[model samples]
Target: MDENYSLAVPFYDLWHEDGHVPLIRELLPPLLKGVERSVIEIGAGTGLVTRVIAQETPAEIYAVEPALGMRSVLVNRLAEDPELLRRVTVLPCGALDVEVDEPVEAIVMISVLQSFPAEQRAELWRVLARQLEPGGRLVFNWRERAVPVPGDLEVMGSYEVGRHTYEVAGQVLEVAGESVTSRFVYRIRQRGVVVSEDEAVVTNHWPAEERLVSELEAAGFSRDAAPEGMEVWRLP
Candidate 1:
């Protein structure tokens, strides 16, 4: 099954009103330090991290994304900033499908690894391995499964950008097998009356850290020093 997140695609940024922009900008500089040649970012959703990487790193960046709706937003973001437009080349495809002529200095997939199933994780690593230059680093997060707990719902306070008001709510949908699914509901009100509503269901895999490290090891990667929940692997 494909990792489709098109339901709440229109308001994807709206749902993330938890001061994510500054947070990511602050966190990305350290992750991309010491890289000067080139970098590739997978699943560059809404170009948040991609934007930061472009700004912080003096390297050419290739951002691969499969979702059309998110790509639309990404393109808009690029257009708004000429510097980002000049530095980044947004590819309309997933990581596995991207074609890199030269091995990259780094591969970044932040908050995106959990979307791949365990069976597919190996292949994903293999594809990324082919794109990495010797001594290249691959950084991503390994999320732990902690959702769908009985009667748990988050009221993600409403937001108003000019005239359109967004009321967002979320809850854990289920914990099935190796994946935990979360659902987000967004209601758009132009003038109080409900104009539109959307639901986005996202499922993420949370394999044991040991299992993931083993998979990476099998794919010829060595773990680097990083905080918990972060995986920084090097290609030999």
Candidate 2:
């Protein structure tokens, strides 16, 4: 888990429930259509995407989330429904450390690729391959990203909750090779007055599409057709 999210947990769902989640809701069902036995979800933050997976398939879910704060919210969300509580098994560990009783049919990773840096992705792929059945599928979202130019603070998203406004602002601090460092500020306001704020500096890696394809191919995965902005690779 990225330590950065530990500070942003309170505002995560508020910002993301409307951000890219709707796209995940739209794209994931088709990707997960035939996974009937089991699925592993890496970085299951706040159960936003987790709920999408649960609703789309009857497969038992091994939801691996490492951050305590995020996991708490995920557990709380699952507790709301008896079926979710029964079917979704939360794994309290990082992606590389995740373990399941057996190889699963598929693994879904949403907005989580950046968390694993270029050097670690090989091992990440290896870990994923080890836990997937032969011919199993790996589904994740990926799009070519333009190199970032250092930028000043800009408001990313804002939402109104009760009388308070929760706002997220970010600034690009540095760009080196495949890594970008940025600072995110989470703010709360009431009656236009700032009430509280927290900040986190997060670094994310962005590998070229060619590099990703090469890495996955080297790891024994072959490309499969997928919707735009999503990639599906199958182990053979």
Which sections of candidate 1 miss by over 4 Å? 1-4, 17-21, 145-147, 150-153, 190-192
**Per-candidate count of clashing residue pairs (backbone under 3 Å):** 0, 0
TM-scores across all candidates?
0.89, 0.98
lDDT tens digits, residue span 115-210, model 1: 788888888999999999999999886646544463466767678878988887778778877787887777888989888887777777878777
Reference-based TM-score, model 2: 0.98
Candidate 1: Cα lDDT at 194:
82
The parts of candidate 2 lying over 4 Å away from their true place are: 1-3
RMSD of 2: 0.9
TM-score of 1: 0.89
lDDT of 1 at 210: 78
The sequence of per-residue lDDT tens digits that candidate 2 reaches over residues 1-236 is 35678889989998898788989999989999888999999999999998999899999999999999999999999999999999999999999998899999999999999998998999999999999999899999999989998899999999999999999999999999889999999999999999999899989999999999999998899999999999999998
